[model samples]
Structures are given as C-alpha cells and as structure tokens.
Target: MRRTDVAEAWLGVGTAALMTALAPLAGATLAGNVGAQLLRDQQGWHRTTAVLTENAAYTETAVAAGDTGRAEAMVRWTAPDHSVRTAMALVPTGTRAGATTAVWTDAAGRLRHQPMTAHQAEVLGDLAGACAAAGVCLVLVGGRRVVVRVVLDRYRARAWERAWAEVEPRWTHRHA
Candidate 1:
C-alpha cells in the first residue's frame, strides 16, 4: 500500500481497538458504581433506624421524667441491635439543684461520679427536644449534641444526587 493509505489503515485499526477495550471497562465501572450505591443505600437505612431508635430512647426518658412531675433523668446507650438499654438509674424528684449533673457508668453499668458542665447539659436538653420533635435520636459523647435531622427519607435523595455527581464524570469520560 502507499504510505498515506497505510497510515489511514493504521489509524482506523487503532480507533477500533480503543473502542473495543473501552466498552468493557465502561461496563465494569458501571457495575462497580451500582454495587457501591446499593451498599450506601443499605448503610443509610441502617443509620436512619439507629437515629430513630435513639430518638425513641430520648422520648422515653423525657416521658419518664415528665410523668413524675419532677426533673427525672436517665442515661441510655444504643445497642448493636438498634435498641436502647438503660445504663443508669433514675434520680427521683427533689434532688440537688444544679445546672449540670453528671452520672458516669462503667462498662458493667456501675454508676460513677461525673461533673458535667452547664453548657453540656443545655446542649443535651436541646438535642432531646430536637429528637422528640423530629422523631430521631441524638447521642452526645464529649461535646455539645447537635441534631440536624438527617433522616434517610429526608437525605436519601440528596445522597443519591451527590453519588451521581461523583460517578457521572467518570462514566462520561469512560464512554467518550
């Protein structure tokens, strides 16, 4: 073949090979993204359930306190099964008047003395209110508790939108 003809043939062959190789790569990437999305969805569902369970625990504590017509209090932990287990005792009415009360519990559920700050207590009270209003739970460990109401139904669509934005560019480049 002439030089120009041979060059054209080589270019066409390279284009065909690239296209063939890219097709399977695109398919594999799509499958991976789908699998990742499924896993994310499952995790989001589990988190939502956990939040709901925690909210219930907060409500229970509030109700128990309210029923006694005094400032009753209890501390609970979220179990692995998404259930709240009471970890501390209920302080009855007419106890000491303090801005913050700290009740520490050991791994064996034994009560230990803790000194909580007023700010921490106020934040917990706000979280409790938010949980009761939103029907979701909030658990604070060392700092202020802030509940943003990130329910699965409320944020799932946004999460999927974000996931798509992350995946789409890769997908377009692969296909192109």
Candidate 2:
C-alpha cells in the first residue's frame, strides 16, 4: 500500500475507536440526567400524596367529631386498618354547653349525637400547645373546629417562606 493510503487508513481507525469510547460515556451522562429528573418527579409525587393523605385524615376526623356532638379542638381517629390518627380541629356553637351542635360518628364508627361540653376551653388550650409544637395553631370558635391562622414569628416566617418556596413548585392546589 502507498504510505499516504496507509496513513489515511490509520486515521480512520483511530477516529472510529475514539467515537466508540465516547459514545457510552455520552449515553450514560444523558441517562443519568434523565434518571435524576425522574427521581425529582417521584419525590414531588410523594409529597403531594402525603399532603392529600393528611387532608383526608383531618377531614375524616372533623366528620367524626362533628357527628359525635362533641365538637372538639382536636380529633383522634382510628382507621379501619387499626392505624391511629390525630389532627387539630374546631367546632362552632351558637348555644350554651350541653347543647347539641351536631351528630358525629362515635369511636365504634356508629352514628351518635354530640353535645357541647364545658371542658372545651381546656381542650382548646391543650390543642394550642400541640399546634405550636407542630408549627400550626388551633382554636375552637363558636364551639366549631377551625385551624387558627398561623402567624409565625418574623424569624420563623422567613424560614417558613424559604421552605414553602421550595415546596411551592410541587403544589398545584391551595390549602384552605
């Protein structure tokens, strides 16, 4: 073979080998980026699911408390699967203690009437303490369940805002 032809052949072989070596690396880098994006998506999904689950639990507890005629500042629920759940709550009433405000499901899952109680104020205080610890606030106004509007300390609010901003991108709905 001519010297020039031999040189050309070697150059082509070297180019082919370089491409082969880089191809897998390039593919792997692309795959890794896609995998990371998928992981983030999954994490967002899990966070959304967790928020939905919490809302469902609170709703059930409120329904149960309202059904029992014992509108409380908090409700503890035991799921059919025997899982225990609790949440801060509120109940409103227009009348005095012992008055029936509403009907609620009892601990046994049976329907029953709930009467207002004098101990509610004490319960509300306890619930407030719990809410403070949980970064939330609770109040029973008019003997009804209501989540107190959270007014964090200024320093805490900044931190909360930052954290909320991070999670805000993942949330599509507003909490009431």
Candidate 3:
C-alpha cells in the first residue's frame, strides 16, 4: 500500500514521450554531424581511378576481421593538375601490376582514406539512437521493478511477524 513507485505516473509518461521524440531528434543530429564531417573530409579529398605500377611486392594475410588479404603496391594516378603521381596503395593479394583501384586524395592530390557515404552515416546514426533509447527504457523498467519488489517484501515481512506473534503465545503456554 506504500507508494514505492520509482517514477510518478506523469513522470513515466513524460519520459516515454521524450524518449520517443528524442530518438529521431538524436538521429537527425548525428546525421548532421556525419554530413559535416564528410564535408570537412572532402575539402582536401578527391577520388581517382588508379592503376598499380608493379606486381605485388608481397602478400599479407590479416587475422583480423574484414582485413583478410592485402597487397602493398605502388599505384599511378593523374592528378587534377594534370600531373602523374605515384603512391603506395593497398590492393588484393596477387593483383597484377596494371590492376585498377579507386584512390581518395586531398587537395594536394595526396592519397587519402575513403569517406563514408551519406547512406552509411544515416544508417549508423539511426542504429545508435535506437540503442540509446532502448537502454533508457530498460533502466527505467529495471529500477521500477526493484523498488516495487522491496516495498512488497517489506509489507510481507510485517504480515508474517503479526501472524507469528498470535501463534507464539499459545505454543509457549502449552510448553509451560
């Protein structure tokens, strides 16, 4: 009968509504940040279709996920300034010298890592927001359960004590 609710009724409704609304809002904010980062990355970066200039110097097998095999090799690409540039790039193992690969570059035509696409950013952001919302909900529910359990246990303990007191006198008198 004692109120041991972790959150008031209005507070629970408010939290639920806020979480529902903030999920999309957080996703949107994260998406915007992704876009800003991509823009910053693009400032000095460009993509070039380049060809390997020599046979794979050596093949490397990575034990890590998504990075199983790689061949380090030199590649040639024409810069935006109409100059030919050669840079070291990673390619599939056993690649022939003339195999073509996509290379990202900076304003100075230096090789740079590829940037994530807009779709990837959006998807990642949405997933993050959903996970955060779920975590919040889980914490709220778990807290409420713990509080309710403690309150109920206390009430049950009081009832058990009262019942035992009534039976204890008769048992003691019989023994005497």
Candidate 4:
C-alpha cells in the first residue's frame, strides 16, 4: 500500500479511538448537567393536600381490570397565600369526589409535578446524555469519513490525470 494509504488508515484508527474515549465522557458530563438542572428545577416545589372533585372520566362502577393506578381528577387546594386554587391532577384510581390526596404545587399555587427523586433525575439525565453522545459520535465520525473520502478521491483523480497525460504522448506518438 502507498504511504498515503497507510497514513489514512492510521488517521481512521486514531479517530475511532478518540471517539470511543469521548463518547463516555460526553455522556457523563451531559448526564450530570441535565440531572443537576432537573434537581434545581424542583427546588421550590412543595407538596400539598388537594381534595378530589368531580371528573367525568371516572364513574361509580368498579375500576376496570387494566386500571393504571392513577387517573386525572379535578382537585382543589389552598395555596401558601391562603387562596384557593383548582386544577386537574393525577390521583389514585377509584378515588371518589371529596377524597384528599397529596399533590405538588409551584410557588404560584399552580399545580405541578412532584419533585423528581434523585434516581429519576439520574435516569432522565442518562437518557438525554446518551442520545447527545451518540449524536456527537455520529457527526464527528461521519463527517470525518466524508471529508477524507472527498480528499482522497480528488487526489486520486489528479494522479490518474497526470499518469494518463504522461503516457498518452508516447502511446499515441503525439507530442504536445
């Protein structure tokens, strides 16, 4: 093989090694950042007791066998300002109107999802990070491949033209 081919092969090997090393580092960094951000977003969230109200979706009949444990229900709760607020929240299925359940609320007394547990945050962060890492790896390696291929193709084309030019005069008995 030509020296250029050897160099190209080495470049590919180096790129692969670099990407392999970076994927995990990128994943971990992104995961930590995302997880930390998620945790921070939950900082001001608080839990409150909310009374379930009427919901058309749930009927007096027994819950179906496939009940998912939680269902959307109208609920009212007192905010920190002593003002009453109402909204839909997820509560245990089969809960009747007037039943109370724990719900999360933001500072503005708006219904919000409960604070994510550390495990939940980590899991979500890991997922996001993994996706980001995969994307990074793909773009880097794929872009490298395309660039290298283009450069090599152009080089080979030029070399072929030069070789043909040198041979044509002698082969055809024609001089420029």
Candidate 5:
C-alpha cells in the first residue's frame, strides 16, 4: 500500500469513468450527423432509364482481371426537368448503341451514383459509434498504464535509495 497507490487507482478510475461517459455521447452525435448526411444524399439522388450511346465492349485489361461482363459507357437520360443529360454509366458488356440502360441522377439532372439507404446509414452509424468507443477505451487504458508505471518507478527508486543509504555508512566503517 504505497502512498501513491491510491492516487494511481483514482487516476485510472477517473479516466475510465470520464471516457465511458463521454465517448458514447460524442459517438452518438457523430453518428447522428452521418445519418443526416445520408438522408440528404437519399433525397438528392434520383433513378432513371438511359440508353447506351456506344458499344460497351469489355477491354483486354478488364477481361484479364476476370471482369464478368459489365463495363462503363456513355448513356443519355431525360432529367426531372425533361432536359437531355448524357454521361458515362455502367452497362452490360458488348452493349450496342441505342440500347436502353437504367441510371441515377442528381437534382441538377447530372448523372450520379446511388444513394445510401436507411439500413446502410444505420450500419455506418453503428460502426462509427463502435470505433469511437473502442478508440476511447484503448487510449484511456494506455494512458492509465503509463501513469501506473511512472508512480511505481518512483516508488521503486525511492526504496532502492533508502536501502543503499542504510547500508553504505556501516560497510565503510567496517572496512576501515
């Protein structure tokens, strides 16, 4: 029961308590922000059918990489404003010109990727929360270990100095 043992214990407990309480709060906030962003993305994106403007033949490099069949090619689709929009979109391999293909678009009628679903947002939120909690625990535990090590090192050094002090004078007198 060293004098600083209580201090060390308190430091560890206090750190753990603070982290356990605060980490989840911060995590939840960040997760909520992420969910909100995903909601915005879902609202901004729209799906539409497009036509292949050219042959979507598979490239030699893609074939060598074991591409099943799909490739990217230019396609045209009518936007929400009924404006013509043409952009590169994924289509079946060897798709000929004038073939219809489905695509997604943004509010501006530009070709866009699919939006994240609610389930995907939930999963992402959970992952972010879990990572934050885990990271907090890891950092707190490591910091506590460092504190404990420093306290114990001081205790051991003092013990060694006291023991040496008691023996040094007696040994010197005996030798003389």
Candidate 6:
C-alpha cells in the first residue's frame, strides 16, 4: 500500500472504466452512421399498401409458440408505375384475405426489406461496442497481470540469490 501502488491502482481502474464507457458511445456513433448510409441507399424504393389475397400461413410450431408467428401470403399492390403487381409476402399471422398492409418495393416491383431505423442502429452499435470493449479490457488486464507476475518473479529470484550469497560462507564455515 505504498503511494505509488495506490496511484497505479486508481489509474488502472479509472482507465478501465473510461474504456468501457467510451466503447459504447463510439459504437452508437458508428451504428448511427451506418444506419444513415443504409437510409441513403434505400432511396428510390417505393412504399405502397398491399392487399392480402389469402389467409396468412404459418408453421404449426411457430403458432404454438404464441409469438408473432412468421407467416406469408399472396399480396397484390400497385407499383409506382401504376401497374398492378402480385407476389408472396410476409405478413402477421391470422391476417385474413383483403387486409391491407404497408410494404416496400423496388422499381421493378420486387419486395425489399425496409431501411434501418435509428433506434435499431443505436442498439446494434451499443451491443457491438460493448462486446468489443469487454474483449479489449480482458486482454489488457490479463496481459498486465502476466507482466506483473513475471516482474515479481524476477524480483523474488534476485532477492533469493542475495540472501543465499550472504549465508553461504557462514553455513559452509569458509570466510571470504
């Protein structure tokens, strides 16, 4: 508990905490940027209302799970060009025929996933950043501990050599 040791300990703790906190912020920023890029790329996609042509079908297991069961149904929608298009699309389970839902389509009237939302980007960024930070902290802490152990071992070896040198002549009854 020397002053230097106390100071070093505090510094290590502060640095670790700072790294952990900073990683999430960086991650969030990165995620937001990526999300924005996705939004930009999603330009020219058309959003239109689609009508379900049949009852949405879902797997029995998925329905039994009580989740928003994955379901697909035939849907019909007019493209931006004013031409009617028909295709199979994912829909909420139990949606009956004639129900209308919003969908995104490319210029050729092909279905596409929507752009990344801000909230989704932030969450993804936070998770990725936190995991990365944790990995970095673990590696640094482990490396530090290993180095400290090696240094302490070297000190102990030197101390032992000196102590043995002082006692060797007396123990052997030979004055140097």
lDDT by residue (tens digit), candidate 6, 57-164? 676756677656658789999877788889888788889999998888987777887656767766665666566656666766775566556755566677779989
Candidate 2: tens digits of C-alpha lDDT, residues 1-176 = 54444654565565456545554445455445544544343331210000111121224565665663323443444434466544433344222333222224434433233432335434544444444433311111211121112322344567679889878877956553
Candidate 3 lDDT over residue span 57-173, tens digit each: 454343343464676689999888889999888777677888898888888777887767777766765666566656666666666556546755576678779988878889888
- CA lDDT for candidate 2: 0.40
| TM-score per candidate | 0.24, 0.24, 0.50, 0.81, 0.71, 0.53
Q: Give the TM-score of candidate 1.
A: 0.24
lDDT of model 4, residue 32: 96
TM-score of model number 4: 0.81
Q: Enumerate clash totals for all models, in the order shown.
A: 1, 16, 2, 0, 1, 0
* Pairwise lDDT winner, candidates 1 and 2: 1
Candidate 5: lDDT of 14?
Answer: 96
Poorly placed runs, candidate 2 (over 4 Å): 46-176
Q: Which one wins by lDDT: 4 or 5? A: 4
**What are the runs in model 3 whose C-alpha is more than 4 Å off?**
5-14, 48-53, 57-71, 76-88, 92-95, 98-102, 108-110, 135-176
Q: Which stretches of candidate 5 lie over 4 Å from their true place?
A: 58-69, 77-86, 149-176
lDDT tens readout by residue for model 4, 33-58: 99999999888889899998865265
Total residue pair clashes for candidate 1: 1
User: Poorest 10 consecutive residues of model 6 by lDDT?
Assistant: 1-10
lDDT tens digits, residue span 21-94, model 1: 65445545554555454444333222111111111123355566565533334444454555555533334343
For all candidates in order, the CA lDDT equals 0.42, 0.40, 0.70, 0.85, 0.81, 0.74
lDDT of 6 at 74: 90
lDDT of 2 at 50: 7
- Which predicted model would earn the best lDDT? 4
Q: List the residue pairs that clash in candidate 3.
A: 44-106, 44-107
Candidate 6 lDDT score at position 11: 58
Residue range 1-176, candidate 5, lDDT tens digits: 76677787788789979897978987787788777777777697778889888989887767888885878889988888898878887788988999887787888888877777888888897788778877877888888888778866778789879998889879887542
Clashing pairs in 4: none
Specify the poorest-scoring 10-residue window by lDDT in model 1.
47-56
